[model samples]
Target: MSCDAIGSRLTARDIGWGPNAAHTLIEKVSFSLDAGDRLAIVGPNGAGKTTLLRCLYRGLVPTTGSVYVDDEDIHALPARKVAQKIGVVLQEMPADFPFTVKDVVLMGRIPWRVGLAGWTDADRQQADHALEHLNLQHLSSRTFSTLSGGEKQRVLIARALAQQPQIIILDEPTNHLDIRHQLEIVDLLSSLKLTVIATLHDINLAADFATKAALMQDGRMSAFGPARTVFTEDRLSGTFGVKVRKRPEVTSGFTFSLAAS
Candidate 1:
């Protein structure tokens, strides 16, 4: 599927968010992504990767600088317009509502829903298709609250996919997944070929799935480029303040070993 038909390129310029209570979150960060580009944002905890993604998704408006979709300022657009362009899956979510798995996934269609704003036949079909894509078809009828952590995560992603967004943002998407599901999610994303900006903790997974990688440290973008240049030992080690070795793995294209910091 071509992403060109989706919204325009997403860009951030001199973005920063902060307050006296919270230290500077993002600092003069700038980057742009075109359609069909899979860009992974990697950093250690407190590195402001989430803050930067929030700015891009308009979850938190930048305290300084600006964000744009194509050339138009994102803040100026309607929320629905922005929602139509991007879908975000947060690191941790607590859904207490008694919604069914299918009901939860179907919620993604809300953006497309207007006056009548209800799930259409096509929407139901798309929802099922999304679940099928993630091998969650069997769980569609299950209660979301009853599913396992990994199952919930996959279902959430399926919901995002059902949205049919041009760009998708994920915050630590692999948080609670097992090896198989983790790889499955990454592999699925790599195949979708959407404009994906993900906050990933797994360096090797980022290297394997992302077309480009952005290194964030202390609320600033340290490096942004192809995986080969950003995933080097020196860069990863320096950014994380720990030894990270690139090991040849049987399953994954690359793996990282933690050494003395």
Candidate 2:
């Protein structure tokens, strides 16, 4: 399937969130993603990467600053309207979903539903396109609860694509998979050719797949630029507290040695 023209610009303006005066999870985080730009957010655990993501996708409204789709503030838009423009694939998914793969993918059309109406031909067609695009056609009639981890993840992405959003935001797209599945998913994400923003634990995968990169440290943006520029040895070593190494001869290129206890 072809990439959609809904590839609009997404921006954040020093957004922040906190419950109390003493506890800020994410603060002063900012970045901009143009059409067809894939940005990977990489950082150590507890660096507020997920918190920052929540703010960007309107999963939470920041206590400060704003997230924008082109020129309109996302928080100000209706939730349904925002859903029509931004589709999110979360890090964790339900252990079991009581539906077929195609039915689950069709759920992405919920935001576009008219009052009390049945599924339209267009909805089914869009879902089919998503399935084919992600190579999930063979699994369309399978029970979602029976699929393997990798298959489940692919189905979730297909669901997101069925939304026909301008941008797709994924949190840790390769969380529980083995090396092969992880590489498979990473390659699929790279080939999407849509505006994508994802949080990845693997910096090497991030560097290889993303056009842009954002490094988050302690709820702040350490750097934001082309992936190669932001994934340098110094930044990786310092932010992750490890000895980062580059092996030009290797496929993954960058690796790390653990810090002394």
Predicted model with the maximum TM-score: 2
* Residue 260, model 2: Cα distance from true site in angstroms: 4.7
lDDT of model 1, residue 121: 88
Candidate 2 Cα errors over 4 Å, as ranges? 1-3, 250-252
Kindly report which residue pairs in candidate 1 clash with one another: none
Q: How badly does each model clash, as a count of residue pairs?
A: 0, 0
Model 1 agreement with the true structure over 46-144: per-residue lDDT tens digits: 999998889898999888989887787879899998887788899877766488889988988888887886679878887888888888889888989
Global Cα lDDT for candidate 2:
0.90
What's the TM-score of each model vs. the native? 0.89, 0.96
The lowest-lDDT stretch of 10 consecutive residues in candidate 1 is 1-10
Residue 214 in model 1: lDDT = 95
| CA lDDT of each prediction against the hidden true structure | 0.83, 0.90
